[model samples]
Target: MKLIIAVVQDKDSNRLSKHLVKKGYRATKLASTGGFLKEGNTTFLIGVKDDEINDVLDIIQENCRSREQTVSPVSVMGGNVDSYVPYPIEVEVGGATVFVLQVEQFHQL
Candidate 1:
């Protein structure tokens, strides 16, 4: 068995969830916060057979796309007042961080 942990941006979470459902994949969703962008995120705990790992990964990759976003570093991530830049910069966001782990045992009740 494999445990897939996918942390995706809020914008892509809904879409990803839908896809998983459509494909008959069950997942446990958790609300999470991102450290870099200080934005909402959703973490999915998906348990699947080893053979399904690639399919789950592909679904996550296809849904969570990385795109450039303009954000003020100081306002969002925070910075020293002395070295604050009062300008918006383009940064890439909207991607998933996934980890697949092997499960030694599985039991559901």
Candidate 2:
């Protein structure tokens, strides 16, 4: 058995969960936060047989996509002033970080 841990953006969580359930794969979703962006995220825990690993991965790939975004730097402008930039910069966002682990045992009651 394998444990698939997928941490996806909050916006994509609903769609991903729906797709997983539609494909007859059980998943547990938890509220989480991203380390880099410090944004809201959703963590999914799925325990599946070895043969089904690819299927789970396919669903995640289809649902999670990375793109560019804009953000502003955390610095003062106009010298020794407590003012920030009026506009934000662009950066990359919207992706999934996944991890697959071997499970020694799995039981459901």
Candidate 3:
């Protein structure tokens, strides 16, 4: 068995989940946040047999797509001000960070 851990963008979670269900795959979704962008994310846990690993991977590849985005850096309103706000900067965003691991055992009640 294999455990597929996929961290996808929040925007794509719903669609991806639906797609997986339609394809007869079960997945558990959890809300997550990205450390780098501090943005909302969705984590999916899928348990699949060895033979089904490729199918799960194909589904992820089709759903989780990466794109470039522009983002701004944080800036201070005034030099004397203690608080600071981020300014809009261009940066790349979107895409999924995925990890697959071998599972020694899996049981469901």
TM-score of 3: 0.73
Question: Model 1 over residues 70-102: C-alpha lDDT tens digits?
Answer: 987666555467756667888787888888998
* Per-residue lDDT over 1-109 for candidate 2, one digit per residue giving the tens place of the 0 to 100 score: 9999998988888999999999999999988886833489999999999999999999998887787666665532557455667777666667888999999989987
Candidate 1 deviant stretches above 4 angstroms: 36-38, 69-91
- Model 3 per-residue lDDT tens digits across residues 38-81: 48998899999999988888888787677655544443345655
lDDT of each: 0.86, 0.85, 0.80
**Candidate that scores best on lDDT:** 1
Candidate ranking under TM-score, highest first, comes to 2, 1, 3
Q: TM-scores across all candidates?
A: 0.74, 0.75, 0.73
How far off is residue 24 in model 3, in Å?
0.4
Candidate 2 or 1, higher lDDT: 1
Span of 10 residues, lowest total lDDT, candidate 3? 69-78
The residue ranges of model 2 lying beyond 4 angstroms of the native Cα positions read: 36-38, 68-91
**Pairs in steric clash, model 2:** 69-91, 70-89, 70-90, 71-89
Q: How many clashes in each structure?
A: 0, 4, 10
